[model samples]
Target chain A: MKKFIEKIIQGLFTVSGFVTSIAILLIVLFLFTEGMGLFKNKLVEDGYQLVVNKQNDVSSLSAEQIKDIFDGEITNWNEIGGRNQEIILFRLNDISNYFTDEELGSELEFVPEKISELIAQHPEMIGFIPQQYIDNAFKGKVLEAGKIGFSDIFLGKEWIPTATPVSFYGILPLVTGTLWVSLVAILLALPFGLAAAIYLAEMANHKMRNILKPLIELLSGIPSVVYGFFGLIVIVPLVQKLFHLPVGETGLTGSIVLAIMALPTIITVSEDAMRNCPRSMREASLALGGSKWQTIYKIVIPYSISGITSAVVLGIGRAVGETMAVLMVTGNSAVIATSILQPLRTIPATIAAELGEAPDGGVHYQALFLLGIILFVITQIINSSVEYVSAKNKI
Target chain B: MNITLKKRRSQHLAFGIVSLLTYSIVAILIIILAFIIIRGIGVINWEFLSTAPTDGMTGGGIFPAIVGTCYLILGSAAFAFPVGIMSGIYMNEYAPKGKLVRFIRMMTNNLSGIPSIVFGLFGMALFVNKLSFGDSILAGSLTLALLSLPLVIRTTEEALKAIPYSFREGSYALGATKLQTIRRVTLPMALPNITTGLILAVGRVSGETAPILFTCAAYFLPQLPSGVLDQCMALPYHLYVLATSGTNMELQRPIAYGTALVLIMIVLLVNITATVVRRYFANKVKMN
Candidate 1:
């Protein structure tokens, strides 16, 4: 009877790990199932069209042509599009007059300035609006969903993804915005977090390490919304007034907020890995007359490459995945930017900002899920790469 | 190389500076704790504990939120502890350094890194939509359970690994079978650690918001959680509402701070008790 019970216990244990692995697989599968619908229509995968210049048969239009192709009244001689004569560029506005919701920053704002610029320089240039703006009046002519499928939102300059079934779910602004914030966050966090970790693991005395350790761990337990609150009250206005910018809610401020939040995790994990590094190795390095810093850099760090990198990568992951803080501080502007100070959107922030009111399984919903998938993939790449490098170093 | 007075002074400076970081951490903790206690304590009269919340946070105590907090934690413990502990047992004892075991190890680590909101999304999709467990405490607890499991597994695995092998061999030497030895000897030895892990797990689920936001959290609640399937008001969600804001910004902020204070206290108490028990046993071990 005892032997039988022993066998039963062993059997149960064998199966438990298998069950846990299956749970993770199910999560990945569910994400893909929810998001695979966006790729089905297949009109365009992820590219912009050249608008097929009829006169010159130019396969690709110049940058000016791309610009003129967006302005409404660029319709005359030498009007951009690579020195072409007498061009008639078609815009969605020329096709239909469906302009509403002035609060949404209507196409009219960009249309006027661009139209004058096109008219002044080259009369024959035309601009391209979204296929949604192209509507029924413009259908069966030159532009439609037939020419550009749903994914063109990522391809274009516009930032709107919440327009749903009617408008393009342009993720370009939000994606770039998120990338910019997280990128800056990683830059700020990586060095400080690493140095702190190094100090705790290789240098600090036991009592000091104990006190610092739990405090850092406790920081993660602090709710992220509080961090959001802090950013709004403190960081946002301070930066705003300090720089005298239009608003303090820019990507740089968001990065700082997130960096503070991420410091705990990066410090804790990296310190643990470094602390676990063999004492013998360090002693040997010192026996060879190496200084403390030299021992740490040459001996300890060399043995712990994977841990430090994993620490940095995980910090980057936190920056990428963080939502509420990013949403509250990044001004929610869905625009691509070159400067760290500019307001921007991130994929996670875009999804969080709009997911609550987003109509379920609508174009906006699908688009948000698509962004989630992108975020998921980027983290997976980071996670798997860390695991791979760690394993490689071990062998 | 010759030792210089400057080198010694600089080394002293480095030690002073590095250790100074500990002061800042402790200071931050004290400031945050004091802010919570002051705000949370003033309004936390006996009536506040006994009464229920009413319209616009004017005359509401956090009775339901506290009870709901308790019920939610109990449910999450129920949901997570059995499976997580079992998985740990399997990893430590049965699966021994094979490819499958290695894969399981990696998955456990990866599981912890997943963002809480993504877990919220998964719960929203799976529980609210697929299982039809819409906005219920059971739904919330199960999601919290999933979130807590990785920690439980890691903690329990370490706990189990700490047991010396001599106890196992002695039981087996008495002609006791493997199952008998583990149950009679190994399990009793690991019980304290198991409780330690459970305490930590409880602390984790109590404070979590994102997953519960998607699965359960109602904006306003005047009642208590009556059953497993019932919708409930949770402390974290209430705090989330109060802090980030809703219609009642002025009324809710103090209550939110009070709730946060209550949360931090509960977690601190649990951790301290566990540490004391651990120290007691360690002392006993040393005396022997």
Candidate 2:
């Protein structure tokens, strides 16, 4: 009977292992299918455009003339000096504009490529995009569509990714805010976390370590939304009074909150790595006439640099990927700031701020996905750095 | 002697800096806990727990969310643990040391790298809409199972790997079949670790919000879930709604804090219990 039961158990194990692999495969395949499905539909209505002739004839305009119309730094549609008619430009959601609510909704479902084609076919049409994608594709067909010429993105400093009252999805403010907040957070928390880690790993007695270590690790598991509310009620108010600001939910408040949120991750990972450091190295540094602080600074930090890097990256990931907490406190405004004290929005906060109202597959939706892709790329870069550093260390 | 005095002062400075640093971490933890406890003590009554949520957010109890959390956790475990343990077994026992094992190991590492939102998008595409689960508890539970799989496999594999190779060799020497020895000897000894891993998985699935946002969490469901396939209200989403949406700011403000405090308490309790359980087995093994 026992033999029979054992046979069944072994059979189950082999069977289930196969199933887990299948599940992961299915997940990857499904994303590709949904994302690619939009491209499968072919375009039939490759349309036409208006432009100025090289012969100085305004009636018969070329594609270049039409594109120049849209890219114009001109004040009026007529200021491209083209026709007497106000250039009643029409561009689709995909290439023409970041999607309006109606376009993102069921009213029109133009994939970005279709919009690109639409802009390509119409000379009076305008396309809003990076200058790189804008040229050649729509060069002969459409002009730069809006009144204000495309400004250098770094110089254009306002973000309103989901502004219903105003459609301003320029990400400059959000990008800056995310960086500013994360920079402040890492600056505040990293030193404190590393110091605590040093003490717990090297200096503290076993009982002191035992009581302290798990407590810190336990704190790591606490959710960010909790931290956000704690900040919303407590930190926001405290900062408001301290600074005498009109509102408490400023960038400074957001950073402090993120600092607290990032602390546990930095401490736990750094401490664990420190504890695992070779004992002989510490001894050698001490014997070299190095004081404890000098040894720690010169020897221990260099030894654990890879681990500390991982901790920093993880903390940054936590700060950047965080949505609900920062969203609640950063005043959810997408305006750029000159100082840390001003309220601002981050990319994640922008997404969380507007994802609910966004129509799926809309330009806004794609932009959000684009935001996801950007964030994924950034995190991937950080991760690659960790791997590169790890490989270099040979440890 | 003069050099010694200089060295001692530097040592004291290092100690001071380190002590100050540790005190900051401890101070933050104390402040957070104290704040939560002070507010939570006023909010967490038997009535608050037992009764259903009302029309307003502040007065309602979180019975449904709690029940939904339990239901999703149980469902996720039912789906994930068996398959995860099997994969671990395959790696440890049956699979030869080959390229396939190496590939599988790399894939597991890559699997951990995929962010929770990507998993959310995956769930949205595959389970929530494609499979027509339509934001039901089943979809949420299944996606969570997928999220839980890597953790379960990693932890279980480590646990199985830690078991002494001699025990398995002795079983083989007794003329036992590979399957027979694994079932009768290897599995029983590793059961404690498997339990510990499951406890950790529980904490993971309970707290995770990203995947379920697209698969499981309902924005407003006054009633409790009646079946596994039904839509559900979860704690994380409830907290999100109360905190983010301003339709009822007057009411939501207090509830958000109250819910957060409850969530922190529950997760802490669950984690501590799991740690205690792990230590129990570890000490027992040490004694033997």
Candidate 3:
């Protein structure tokens, strides 16, 4: 009986041991399965079609050109291989502008005919209308938009995932924004974190070290949303006032907040690494008449370089993975940020802000999942490198 | 002599810079804590803690969010603790030292490092959509459980590893089975550290927003959750909504501050408790 129970218990533990590995696999699997489904989706919004005048030369528009035309960046039809006429943007609602409500009827029964007429009348007009509004009898021709391809997402410029005619899923702005904020954060954090780590490792007395170490841990223990709150109330306004910007929420504010958040991880990890340096080395350096700082810079640092490198890698991972605090402070604008002073959005922030309203199993939802996959891959790379570095240090 | 003098001057400068940087970090912490306390203290009345939010979260209090967070904490703990402890036991006491163990360890590290938002997405896919749980406390708890699983496993493994081998050997000499040895000797010895880990996991789970945002968080449900399947308000998501997406930011700012204070206090309390538990256990171990 005892042996049987032990067998069951061992079996249970073995199963539990696989849980985390399985979870990691599942996360990747689910994200990819959901995210990769985006490629199978059409470039245009579901149930919507692009209609143009039959006389127009434009038969097709790539997702990029459609977004550009809609955004008014490509005002001339010739820019997209059409005739040398000005591109006129039209939405389903734009039909009202072309005709009176009485002519369209109260229930909008005649709206489709009116829409067909409007598109047919203006050769330069590109109309985005519902599929219900377009039939074989419609006067205009429908443009065939291809499935959303890899380049449309990876190389596209705009990130308007909810735009009516075409939802752009170009990750460039989010990718750039995420990298820019994380880079700035690392640049700001490394000096302070390294200095603080050095002070604690080399200079602080035992009592001071005890107090400061837990205090830093306490800082880490503070929930990130709380940090977001603090950032919104304090750093956002301060950044705006100092820079004379129109808005308080900017990439700089995010970087500053992330730097502060990353500081605890960097300080704790590097300080432990520095402290792990053998006392014998420091004593030998001192015996050679080297100063305390000299012993630190020459012996301790060199001895723990691998550990410190891992610490820095881990810090970068934290900054890149950080979501709530950056989301709250970074203004959540999906623009290609030109400077730290501009408001921008990161991958995590975009997912957090937009995932709620995205209809389940829709193109927008899958696009957000794709963003999640991108974020997951990036952080996994950073983390696996940290793991490798730390493992090497142990050896 | 000139070279030595210059080295000394440079050393002093570097020391000054390092100390300044160190103290400035502490100062920043102090400023954040002080600013939150000063601004948020006024809003934390008895009514604020006891009442449900009213009028689009502009007035009243954050009672439901607190309850929801508590439920999430409880539910996640219920799910994570047993599995985590078991996994830790397998790693430390049973699993042979090999590449499989190393791979498991690597996966744990990677899982812990994956962005929380990605976990949110995964949870949405697996629990909310695949499992058809809908937006519910159960789904949220499971999602948060996965997020904290790594922390729990690592801490449990560390705690179990700290137990001296001789204790297990002694139990085995008395004809105790492997499970018996662990249950009767090692687990008791490592209980305090395990408790500390569990408390820290609670702190982490309670504060998480992204995982719960899609999995369970309700925008405005003044009433408390009636079942595991019911969607509920969570404090972190509440603060996020009020701070960013609320209808009247000016009116809701105070409540947002109050909710933030409540969150900070919970985290602080958890940290202090874990520290005290660790210190008490350390002293006890020293006495032994």
Among the numbered candidates, top lDDT falls to: 3
The prediction achieving the highest DockQ against the true structure is 3
- Candidate 2, residue B91: lDDT: 79
Across residues B72-141, which tens digit of lDDT does each residue of candidate 3 receive? 9999999999999999999999999889889888888888998888889998999999999999999999
Off by over 4 Å in 1: A1-12, A41-144, A147-159, A245-248, A284-294, A297-303, B1-6, B9-13, B20-26, B49-52, B57-59
lDDT of 3 at B161: 88
Question: Which model is ahead, 1 or 2, in terms of lDDT?
Answer: 2
Please give the CA lDDT of all the candidate structures: 0.69, 0.70, 0.91
Model 1 lDDT tens row, B151-229? 8888778777889988888888898876666678877778777777787788778877767766787777767767877
User: Which has the greatest TM-score?
Assistant: 3
Worst 10-residue lDDT window, candidate 2 chain B: B106-115
* Residue-by-residue lDDT tens digits, candidate 3, A84-169: 99988898777767899899999989988888888889999988888998888899999987999999899987898888678889
- Could you report the DockQ of all the candidates, in the order they appear? 0.36, 0.48, 0.84
Clashing residue pairs found in predicted model 2: A49-A123, A51-A61, A52-A61, A63-A140, A67-A142, A67-A143, A70-A143, A70-A144, A71-A144, A94-A112
Per-residue error (Å), model 1, residue A30: 1.0
What's model 3's lDDT at A33?
93
Assess candidate 3 and give its TM-score to the true structure.
0.94
